[model samples]
Target: MSIDRRRFLCRGAALSAGLLLAPGWRAWAQSAPMLDPAARQARAVRYVEQASAAQDDPAYRAGRRCANCDFFSAGQRCSLFPEHRVSPDGWCMSWTSE
Candidate 1:
C-alpha cells in the first residue's frame, strides 16, 4: 500500500486535533502517579533493590531507569504496576530500557 504526503499530513493533523479536543486528555495526563518513596515501598516497588542497584541481577545496569523503560509511562506511572507513581531514576526486575 502507498500513502500520499498530503493525506498523511491531513490524518496526522486530525489525530492531533482529536487528542487536543478530547475532554479526558487533560485529566488523564494529570493523573500520573506521584512516585512517593513510602507509597512505592508499600506497593512493593523495591526501589532499593532495583535493577540499577549495586550487586543487582546480571541484567541490571548502573544507569537504567523506569522513566526510560518500556513499561513506564509519562515518567511517573508504570504499566507493570499501574496507578502508582514510579521514580524516573528507579529500576526493577522487569525494567526494560527502550
Candidate 2:
C-alpha cells in the first residue's frame, strides 16, 4: 500500500470532523432519561415532578413550571440538569422566566 499526502490530510480531516460530531449525534439520537426527584442534582435544586408539590417552597409561584422556564428546552431537557428530561409540570428553585 502507498501513502499519499493528499489522502492522508483528507482522512485526518474526516476523522476529526467525525470525532467532533459524535457527541452531538449521540445526544440527538437518544432521548435523555426523565429526571429523578431523588437524584442529587434534582435534590440540590429542590426539584419536584409536579409544580403543585413545590408549594411548600418559598420560590414556588402559581404558574411557574419547567415548560415555561427559560432553561427548559422543547424536548423537556433542562439546562441545569443536562443529562435528564424533566416533567413539563416540574418545578425547581432554579426556574427562571428569563
Candidate 3:
C-alpha cells in the first residue's frame, strides 16, 4: 500500500496540533527536575529553598520568593535555571517581580 503526499502531510499536521492542544501537555513539557540548592548554578544565584533563610544576605527582601517572581512558571520551573525546578518558596538574587 502507498500513501499520497497530501494525505501524509495532513495527517502529520493533525497529529502535531492534537499533541499541542492536549490537556496537561504544556505542564508535562514544562516540568523539570528539582533544583539542588548546593548545585553550582544555584550557588551562583544564591538560591535558597526557604526565602527566610536568605535573610542574612543583603539582597534578601522581606517578601520576595520564587512563587512571585517573573521567571517562575507552573510546576516550580524557573527560566533562569532551565534544567531544574526551584521551590515555590525559594529565593534567588536573580528574582524579578512579575
lDDT of each: 0.66, 0.89, 0.89
Please, what are the lDDT tens digits per residue for candidate 1 over residues 1-98?
A: 99999999999999999988676754775577555545645346445324445345565677777777898776367787666666677776676763
Q: For each candidate, give its TM-score against the true structure.
A: 0.53, 0.69, 0.72
Give the CA lDDT, 0 to 100, for residue 88 in model 3. Answer: 92
Candidate 2's error at 39, in angstroms? Answer: 0.4
lDDT against true structure, model 1: 0.66
**Overall local distance difference test of candidate 2:** 0.89
**Stretches of candidate 2 exceeding 4 Å from the true structure:** 1-30
Best by TM-score: 3
Model 3 residue runs over 4 Å out of place are 1-31
Please give the distance, in angstroms, between residue 72's alpha carbon in candidate 1 and its true position after superposition: 1.5
- Across 8-68, the per-residue lDDT of candidate 3 in tens digits comes to 9999999999987776756664566789999998999999999999999999899999999
How do all the candidates rank in terms of lDDT, highest first?
2, 3, 1
Off by over 4 Å in 1: 1-17, 21-27, 35-45, 48-59
**Two-way lDDT contest, 1 vs 3, winner:** 3
Q: Residue pairs in steric clash, candidate 2?
A: none
The C-alpha RMSD in Å for every predicted model, in order, reads 5.0, 7.4, 6.7
Q: Give the clash count for each candidate.
A: 0, 0, 0
Residue 46 deviation, candidate 3, in Å? 0.3
